[model samples]
Target: MTHKDILLVEDNPDDVELTRLAFEEANVANRMVVAGDGAEALDYLFARGKHAGRDASQLPAIVLLDLNLPKLDGREVLQAIRGNPATRDLPVIVLTTSAEPFDVEASYALGVNSYIQKPVDFEQFVWAVRQVGLYWLVLNHPRVA
Candidate 1:
């Protein structure tokens, strides 16, 4: 988190590998850390549980969160993040396979920075990942011009 890694909160192993490969193919330099469940994701962000003693102040540059997850789910995680002042300003993007209107609307309502439906095609998915990484990590600078 201190290095501004891209935190990917996903339970599906295949999706995790695909995203890692996509980011690699896209040549994104930022490291990606995986949290297999919502509770684990929160633990990492708050530096609790197994991630204890880690500095909580240095959060990830961005989070790619999946909605369907075990142990708390993405909505709960997002709520916890937004509710805490320490992580309220963190940029969180909902990257899920779900394209349901409710999911999209709810994510925005929960203060998500972006809602992206995981593209079915590999090439398209890679492109999406590349654009996302480029925009968030390089082109867009919230603190500096």
Candidate 2:
């Protein structure tokens, strides 16, 4: 399958820039859609508000989510996605700073495919982003077409 795009839901500007650069360095040709909050992420996914007229079939290959977000949290966002029949099977990876056991368990319970903690070091962060992009965007076999 082709790497179409990735939805990156991150609140921090530095992390967003790093993730964008990492995807570029990894040679990941897919587009990166940045959503600073959970609400925007949902809008992008469902083609609501400013995202109106978006083709629902053009869902991103992966969603990199942060737990702490404005409007709606990552858990609520995950539940919304999974609850919808159209995006139920979409691949969502919880990538956040929190590695708390409760966060990990709750994310998995919400149907997150993978849960990863952000690295503090800049270089390590880049590497982690590359790895995630590679694994989810290329190596992962999706549950649906």
Name the best candidate (by lDDT).
1
- How displaced is residue 1 in candidate 2, in Å? 8.5
Candidate with top TM-score is 1
Give the distance in Å from residue 118's predicted Cα in candidate 2 to where it truly belongs.
Answer: 0.3
Candidate lDDT scores, in order, read 0.93, 0.90
Candidate 2 on 29-141: residue-level lDDT in tens?
99888999999999999999888888878999999999999999999999999999989999999989998999999999999999989888878877888888778877888
lDDT of 1 by residue, 35-98 (tens): 9999999999999999998899878889999999999899999999999988888889999999
Count residue pairs with overlapping backbones in model 2. Answer: 0
In model 1, where do residues sit more than 4 Å from their true spots? 1-3, 143-145
TM-score, cand. 2 vs. native? 0.94
Q: What global local distance difference test value does model 1 have?
A: 0.93
